[model samples]
Target: MPAPQLVWFRNDLRVADHRALAAAAAAGPVHAVFLKAEAQWAAHGVGANRLAFLERNLRALAAALGVLGIPFTVLEAPRFRDAPGTLLPWAQAQGATALHFNDEYPLNERRRDDAVARAFAQAGVAVHRYTDSVIAAPGTLKTGQGGPYTVFTPFKRRWLATLDLSSAAPLAPPDPQGPVRPLGPALEEAMTLAGAAASAVPAKLWPGGEGEAHRRLTEFLAEAALRYDSQRDFPAVTGTSTLSPYLSLGVLSPRQVLSALLAAFPDALEGSGGPSIWLSELIWREFYRHVVAAFDHVSKGEAFRPAFADLPWRQDPEGLAAWKAGRTGLPLVDAGMRELAATGWMHNRVRMAVAMFLTKNLLIDWHLGEAHFMDQLVDGDFAANNGGWQWSAATGTDAAPYFRVFNPVTQSQRFDPEGHYLRRWVPELAGLDARSIHEPWRYAGGPKAYPKPLVDLKASRERAIAHFKAHAAG
Candidate 1:
């Protein structure tokens, strides 16, 4: 009899379109393992909300793995270095001849994976890695000059040209091994959260499992895809797919998402309407991941454009606290922040507004806002969060121009229109008319309980631009 194959779970929690799991099962009877690296998460500044979300998803994943005759094992390892010690001995005990896992691109994750590969190789066990998370692996696409493309347009052009639909289609779940025992409660117990983080899970807003992910994708394609481009910016309208949480957790793969998309609109890339715009968003996610890998400094919290490293960011704890608490006095920014706090999610357009308010208007360091988003967001992937903050702050490759600072009031007035979104999140200003809603500060005593503007918008905007100009000129 052949030795059993081991499939190690990380962010890719789903059983379908899972290259590692599929490959492992094809080789022989598959067993699965998940390491509860809560200590590692803490060290990485991962917030409690996301941790709770992960726990919920892991429970779902465990059930799915059990049905496939894979005995799921959970262990605790504080950090990446501890993984080999935990995994190697287990693989040997399980009589596993090979170890398999999907690739993760972060610096620490890469280091940990490289270490695991070496240790397994030393133990005379074959190790296999599959790129399941991204559609195209990083560094595969390059410019005519034979170098990585830093700008998004050329990268996207190459990406679309290089895309092979047949290869990117979702894979079928592997055939089950018969008469396997159901998973025990041990794995579930290992994943339970404790302390304040335990209460932060947005259980209703985000249900775990691949089933929920598919339901969301299906619903979006069926009902919302046509209007996605026009209504996505409006926070009140449910124009966007709520699949980011699933995508970020790898409950849904980009290929699975693209399959659904193409099914609805075959010519989505060339056609106008919702499909085209939404496809662009998916590519943006891919671009950021690629950028993180190609430009290693971003993972280290350094600005993509080194010149912005000397940016004179303000130091204000009170302002930071206000922004976090949704009391920033900019209606749209506050609303976005509050929505994130309540639901572990925020509308994409509002995300830009709040990010800009923090990094440009308040002149706070973009890293602070980036870290805060990662802590609070259920869909927080480091690459996306880091890319967005840096872009908003004009400190990243292919960033919004430094002079293009967002005017929060205009953004709210344009997107919210009648202030429906603001009313939903900022109930204190609910009584105010639409005219006063966007700029509540203009209202008498600012509509009762709302805080006054943290900084003069025009003055701060000018200050940010001047600072950037001075640095550039010098």
Candidate 2:
């Protein structure tokens, strides 16, 4: 009997452009398994929306693997601690001689992988780990002094300089090896943990499959890439790529994205325009991953800047609840939150505005907003969510300057100037003109159904700045 190699699928769900799966398939006959870590995800605050997206992607993945003559099994472990014990028996039973998987950079994920690697080693099953998620894995680049660059600019420079597009091109899916017997019953219980299948985001908006991911990328580049830089800030324009959910769930690889970009704009790496600007966004994603891997505290729920960790956060449950429920009465903030509630996603520009209101305007804890986003966003990944919240709150590495708080009204007026986004999400204010929609309270016949501003914006902004200044002085 051939000693079949097992491809342990985690976040990297798709077979196309998959490093581990390709390598394993090239080696010999291959088997694949996805372990559902329910308790672990719950502890990590995995929300219904994200769970539903992941489940859909997994089903798509299983079907993809089935066509390639690889049996795809779904295993269950209540927690990361139970993973090795739960998975090893299955691997041994399948006549597995080796295991392959991709790396996830978070601290807990690293520890879990370490534990699993140890168990596999003791069982004489070789384990191989590939860095497939990010363009560059953490710890690969450094500053002149040999430390990780804390800022994004220098890191991006180094990233662009070091990248070799030829070598980084995406791999083709494995050749079909004829039909194989199906694995056991599909694991539905673990897939629908938060009942995320019932999400308000139109199910049609996201169709799970590698083919669908590529289709979205092609559509975005063809239609929106040229205007991405100018229109990305405006929530009303669909200028941004909605490929984040696919990227987060590993239905698409960064290499695949880069390849497509290079094909569309050959000079993109050295030129400036929509393609370059969008590429920078990808680099930012890389930067956050590097931050989490290089600085462990960010993963531990502590502020990147230690001084800000002790900064007083107001315990205003009412205000916090209002923000979460999209009743803050600030149009931009409310729209973003409502969009998040209605769909498992929000536009990036509005995400910044909403986070700033929660952390600075209301002076609520950044952790609260961070957890809420993780629980709500379909594309929520720890590095991006934590980095974004901390950046908005001015508490993380390379964060916004303490004094540069975002004004919700300004954000609304600037981004949704026509009130298109705001009106769509906050329908009660739909009657107001574009100019007045941003600040409905000031309108002659304000939306009576809408609540008043939760707190005076200017007063709250000043309070937050003063609080930070006082901490610095102390």
Candidate 3:
């Protein structure tokens, strides 16, 4: 019998289109290991909702691996520092001669992988890493000056021009090694030790597994892709594909998504309508991931653009608390926060509104809002969350201009015109008419249960702009 090759599962958990898993299976008999570094994740502000989602996906990965005759083990590392010590002995015990894994680009994860590589080298075990998480890996796209592209538009142009279809095509799942294997007890024990619990998000809201991910993708492409540009901003309508959780956790691959999209709409890349816009959104995801890899400061919680770093963010704890509790009294912002609290997800349009409300309107620090989202969001990916909050705060690459503040009332009137989205989340204002629901403060005999607007929107916007201007001048 040939020596086994151990496949280390990280963010990329699915069986199909998994380069590391395919490589491992081809090398020899494959075994899989997932290091449960829950403590490290918790320290990084990862909340119960995301951890629960991860646990569910881990279980799904184990089941899928079992069908391919690969034994899956869950090891309780608790921290990245413990990973090498925990995994080395397991590999030696299983007589595994090589280890395979897809690369994770965040600073801490990169350091951890490097340490594991060094340890494996000393132990005479080969370590093979593959890029499975992104369509274009970081450092692959560069400017004419031979540096990483900071701006998005030029980077996107290069990405589209330089994309090699042959290499970007998704890999098929590896052939089964032998008969199916029964899952061992380590997985359950590791889950318990890692403190996996019931998620705040409902299971029906986000079903685990690759099959569920693909089903959603197919349905979204078939039904909504064409109208995505038209309906995506409306919170009440299911215009956007609710596949972020799957994409964040790697339950589905970008290649699979792209292939499916092209199969449905051949001119997806070139068209001026919905398909192209949706593709731009996907490119935005890649751009953030690349940003994380290229710029170390963003991953370290520093602003991408240094000019706005010292914009004198306020320390309004009361305002921050209200924002978190979804009682900021601004209907749209409050609704968005409430939606996040209830489902561990919020509409992208509302995410911007709430973030801008916190940072610009209330004068609270963007860091507070960023941490709050990381602690509440089920689809909380560090790169995306960090990139988004910074963008709203006008402190990131291709950020909203400092003078630009999203008027929550105007936004509510435009997007949730009939108040369907507002009423669904903020039931206290349900009886108010569409016009009044947006700005109940202006109407007489408004709901007494709903609080007044937290701040004068116009005054706050002017204040934020003045502050940024003064800071820039100084």
TM-score of every candidate relative to the true structure? 0.98, 0.97, 0.98
Tens digits of per-residue lDDT for model 2, 147-263 = 998888899999999997777899999998778445345444434445565566766777888999999999999999988889899998899999999998899999999999999
* Better-scoring candidate (TM-score), 2 or 3: 3
Which residue pairs clash within candidate 2?
Answer: none
Instruction: Estimate every model's Cα lDDT from 0 to 1.
Output: 0.89, 0.89, 0.89
Q: Candidate 3 at 371: error in angstroms?
A: 0.9
Candidate 1 residue spans exceeding 4 A from truth: 195-197
**For residues 265-346, could you state the per-residue lDDT of candidate 1 as single tens digits?**
9989788788988999999999998988788788888999988887878999999999999998889999999999999899
RMSD of each: 1.2, 1.5, 1.2
lDDT, candidate 3, residue 54? Answer: 84
Residue 69, candidate 2: Cα error in Å is 0.9
Lowest summed-lDDT stretch of 10 residues in model 2?
A: 183-192
